[model samples]
Structure formats: structure tokens, C-alpha cells
Target: MTQPWKPDRGIRHAVIALGTCGVALVAAGAVLDSLWLLGLGTWCLIIAIGMELIYRP
Candidate 1:
């Protein structure tokens, strides 16, 4: 018999937190016109999306 998939809540929460931080950073970067912050935020967002997809339940 095959078992159903289960998500790791801790990882999920961390991913969410990362995504939120990425968004906040992106917004802050835009407001402050900071290229480095914007690049970092974009990188974080990409990693968050990759993690969510790879670790899906």
C-alpha cells in the first residue's frame, strides 16, 4: 500500500516567512531605490518559490 504525502510544517512556515521577507524587501528596495536590496529580494523570492515547488506535499 502507498502512503499519502505529508508536508513538513516547519519548512512550510519558513518558506512563507522567507517569501514575506522577500516581498517586504522588494517593496522597501523599490521605495528606497536600492539596486542591491532589489536584487537580494528577487533572489530570495526565487529561492522561496523553488523550495515550495520542490517540497510540495
Candidate 2:
């Protein structure tokens, strides 16, 4: 039998915060035309979303 999955509240909050920051960074990068910031933001977004998907019940 397989065990059910559960996510911690703190981790979920952190993920949400990370995703928000990522979106902000993406916008800032677009405004400033910075490729580095854009790439970093995209990475953060991907990681956060991936984690959420993996932990989803």
C-alpha cells in the first residue's frame, strides 16, 4: 500500500512567496531588459510550480 502525501503549511507559503517573487522579477526584467533577471525569475517560477505539482494530493 502507498502512503498519502501531505504538504507542510510553511513550505506551501514559501513556495507561494517564491512564485510571487519570480513573477515580480520577470516583470522587472522585462522593464529593464535584463536577460539574467528574466532567466532567474523563470527558474524560480518553474521550481515553485514543479514542487506544488509534486506535492499535490
Candidate 3:
């Protein structure tokens, strides 16, 4: 049987890093009561999702 297709290693690593940073930003935003940080983090998470959709199908 053929192996299933997979994303490139760099893409996988970048996605993971983006997710980690997104969570960290959210946490920092809460701690500092900063709406700007919260919004930025939210956008980061959304971009990660978009990338997955574009690349995984």
C-alpha cells in the first residue's frame, strides 16, 4: 500500500510554532489586560487554521 501524503517538515513545524505563540499571546493578553494582544493572538490562530485548510486538502 502506498503511504499517505504528508505536509513538509517545515510546514508542520511552523504550524506548531504558530499555535504555541498564539496561545502564549492570549495568555499574556489576559494577564496584562491588553485587548490588542488578544486580538493579535486571535488573528494568529485564525491564520494557522487558514493555512491548514489551504495546504491539507
Candidate 4:
């Protein structure tokens, strides 16, 4: 029997990647004392949240 197809996984992968990068950036920012990087990480985190909500399992 044919199985049901699934949606593309690229978005999910991007979300996960961005999430991990954001976490790493946050840690690096804390260690480096760079507000710009910290802000960038915060934005990345927001994007990750949006991506997750849009692509819920």
C-alpha cells in the first residue's frame, strides 16, 4: 500500500538550526560582553519561535 506523503523538512531543519545557533550565540555573547551579538541572538530566538509555531508537529 502507498504511504501518506510528508511535508518538506527544510523549514523544520532551519528552525532547529537557528535555535541551536541562537543558543550558542547567546552563550558567546555572555562570554564576550557584546550587546550586538546578544541582540542578534534574541532576534534569532524570536524567529525560531515563530518558525516552530508555524510548523508544529
**Candidate 2: where is the Cα deviation over 4 Å?**
1-7
lDDT of 4 by residue, 1-57 (tens): 855765646788889899999998999899999998899999999999998887775
TM-score ranking from best to worst?
A: 1, 4, 2, 3
Best prediction by TM-score? 1
Local error of candidate 4 at residue 36 (angstroms):
0.5
Tens digits of per-residue lDDT for model 3, 1-57? 855765466677777888888999999999999999999888888877777777765
Question: lDDT tens string, model 2, 2-53?
Answer: 5476447767997899899999999999999999999999999998998788
How accurate locally, in lDDT, is each candidate?
0.88, 0.88, 0.83, 0.87
Backbone clash pairs for candidate 4 read none
lDDT per residue as tens, model 1, 1-57: 854754577679879988998999999999999999999899889989988898874
| Global fold similarity of model 4 (TM-score) | 0.81
- Return the TM-score for candidate 1, rounded to 2 decimals: 0.82
Give the clashing pairs for model 3.
none
- lDDT of model 1 at position 6: 47
Candidate 1 weakest lDDT stretch, 10 residues: 2-11
